[model samples]
Target chain A: MTRFRLGIEYDGGPFVGWQRQENGPSIQQCLEEAVAATVQEETHVYGAGRTDAGVHAIGQVAHVDILKEIAPARLMAALNFHLKPNPIAVTDCAVAADDFHARFSATGRAYLYRIANRRAPPVLERGHVWWVPAELDAAAMHEAAQRLVGRHDFSTFRAALCQAQSPVKSLDRLDVNRVGEEIQVIAEARSFLHHQVRNMVGTLRLAGEGKWSADDVTAALAARDRAAGGPTAPPDGLYLTRVVY
Target chain B: MTRFRLGIEYDGGPFVGWQRQENGPSIQQCLEEAVAATVQEETHVYGAGRTDAGVHAIGQVAHVDILKEIAPARLMAALNFHLKPNPIAVTDCAVAADDFHARFSATGRAYLYRIANRRAPPVLERGHVWWVPAELDAAAMHEAAQRLVGRHDFSTFRAALCQAQSPVKSLDRLDVNRVGEEIQVIAEARSFLHHQVRNMVGTLRLAGEGKWSADDVTAALAARDRAAGGPTAPPDGLYLTRVVY
Candidate 1:
């Protein structure tokens, strides 16, 4: 028996999210079914992050133990073949050590949010970006984002059903930049509270629109209340870019 | 009646090319139906470029004459509102002179081909990129692509069913460059023969793999025979990026 690590990529448009749910289809459910079909054994796969609905993942990591002695490469190919008709693909696979855990062994996580800051709605990038029809000041958004860096109480950005033990978390990086008509926000940290990145983006958007200033962002963080923050950004733009071990 | 120009963008995965056909839905058909639904009149939409199946368009131009006196913004909004449940979107709209024709008045065309030069099959980019598993040298492809630039008898790269009067055409530009894991081939011309860009891409892929040389490309163009070229690339990676008039 061997624990195998799989590097997964998927379009979240069709799935409920990364974790399994009784309400709808999930990425985990698809992968588990694919694994069962491949090895003829029921198995549970552990993922690095439990993303929300409509959120995508590029370098999502998962691990599953198999009773059949199969090569990781063969297992990956088999899983991809069975995972057909779905938009998911297993990009890479490797045999993992018994101690390695997809969720616990991870040291850092990185996310990217894409906002189509343009007058016209997104056409080519539909379902892949948050279409913000108003003009945004990317430079101002970047400046305001700096105030949210470092360890602080992020209750203003946390989700209502967050299962995290504490609201305090250290943000290693938070950058806002413009690439043509798209405004991109990149965030990296050891972990994040549910909807933390999206909530921060929603608040930062007000600064981008000339509604709020950097000082206002500082005030929101100091309040440490969910009501103090701006509206939560939609999941259409959130992408789990990477998970570092 | 007023002639209006529309800038369109669509994911071609769900269309049978850009022209209206009885086989299935097309981008042109979608626009015409939307126009009928909006202006309360049946109208014919003329397109600047007729893209193929599975080919995307980021900046496709089209024109239609409307009997209703609707503002350009209002007409655009109305058409977009009716184009729902489809991947097609009207990005921009403008009032054009009655003499202007989307097909005939167009003086320049630009196309972009995307090749995912990676080992893994696309996940998020599924149906959006041509995944090339083999290693490709973009610089070598660029070098060979230059040989096919300028005016030439491009019958070697023409399709079997092309309706152009002559195969001789001028290529304004052809560039190959790698952006991280993706290699992009950009082509510009007053107009192109059917399958010209895809044929050039297929031939360039051979050069990228060290199968063909720059001299071979020059020789192929001089042959003026469709069988002399390498092969036609799949439409998945091809995109009609711009139509300049």
Candidate 2:
């Protein structure tokens, strides 16, 4: 058996998140089916992260094992051929050691959140961005984001349905910047509590709009209560950018 | 009646084109109907450029006359409210002289052609860009593009059904550059023959792919015949970036 690591890009608008669900098609199922069709074997592909619905990805990583002896390039082509009509694509593929588990072997993950700060609604990026008509002070948001960085018990930012046992995680970086009409927030971490990034962005947004201050964000973290945090940002604006092993 | 000049932005995926075609909805129709609904009077909005189907716009200009005494900000808000559910927005509006025609008074126009130079088809930018799998030398294409940047008869690049009386037009700029995995071509002119930008991109792509040389591009221009040029690029990658008056 040969194990292959695949780099993927997808438009998550039409998906029911990454994990398989009874509601609709998932990115995982699409990729697994495509691989099964390519190798003529019912193969199961494991992903590094199971992103939520309407969340995009640029460099999502996955792994699958198959018995076929095919070149990585040819396997990529055949998988893409069968994956067509779906918005998922295996952009890169490489041979991997049998022990290289996609999820367990990951060392870090990164995410990007896009906010369109303008009076007018989005025309081209309607479903891909969060539209905030009110002006956001990115500088304030950046300052507020700093208070959430480093190791902390992020219980206030954790989702209620999160499967993780502990809320303690080390946040490597959180950056907020304004580029033209969009305000972007990028977060990197070894691992994240469910909805952690979204919760942080939501609180920073409140700070940017003058509803909260840096002190408020710090207090929320210290409170360690979900009710003390801001609302969860929409999934449409979130993107799983990369997963580093 | 007060004449207003409006700056517009739209995603052309759902529209037939800029012009009002009987087969489907057009951007022009959408704007006119929205304005009429806001002012409670039938209004006609004229655009500086009429983009084809699946062609996007970032800074399209238009002129409209309204009998209602509404401020620019209010007019923008009211028109946008009426234009809801459509991927079109009036980004800016200003009062203009009665004689300021959107089409006739334009002194220059700019367009951007985007090609995703990658192995995999674009997922996030699927409708917004053209995906080309082959590797391209953008620097070589840039050098070749400079040869077509003067006043000349652009018959080789003009569409067969172009309505321009003369093929001779001043080509101000045809700059090409590569940013990461994307190749962008920005073209500007006082006015252009139909399919002029797309035609140039198509031919330049040939040079980028090593199918044609810089000398061949010069020879095609010297020939001044439509058959001497390469094929027209798809409309999906073309964007009406700006219109200068």
Question: What do the candidate models score in CA lDDT, each in turn?
Answer: 0.93, 0.93
| lDDT of each residue in A1-245, candidate 1, tens digit only | 89999999888998899999999999999999999999999999999999888899988999999999999878988998889878888888999999999999999999999999976677677888998988999999999999999999999999989999999999999999999989999999999999999999999999999999999999999999999999999988999989999
**Which candidate should be chosen as best, given DockQ against the real structure?**
2
lDDT of 2 by residue, B1-245 (tens): 99999999999999998999999999999999998788788888899998988889999999999998999999999888988899999999999999999999999999999999999878889888888899999999999999999999999999988999999999999999999999999999988999999999999999999999999999999999999998999988899999987
| Candidate 1: tens digits of C-alpha lDDT, residues B50-137 | 9988899999999999998999999998888899878888888999999999999999999999999977777788788888879999
Q: Write out the backbone clash pairs for model 1.
A: none
List residue ranges in candidate 2 displaced over 4 A: none
Most accurate candidate by TM-score: 2
Each candidate's number of clashing pairs is 0, 0
A23: Cα error in model 1, Å: 2.5
Q: Residue by residue across A185-233, what tens digits does model 2's lDDT show?
A: 9999988998898899989999999999999999999999999999999
For residue B135, give model 1's deviation from the true position in Å: 2.2
How does chain A of every candidate compare to the true chain A by TM-score?
A: 0.99, 0.98
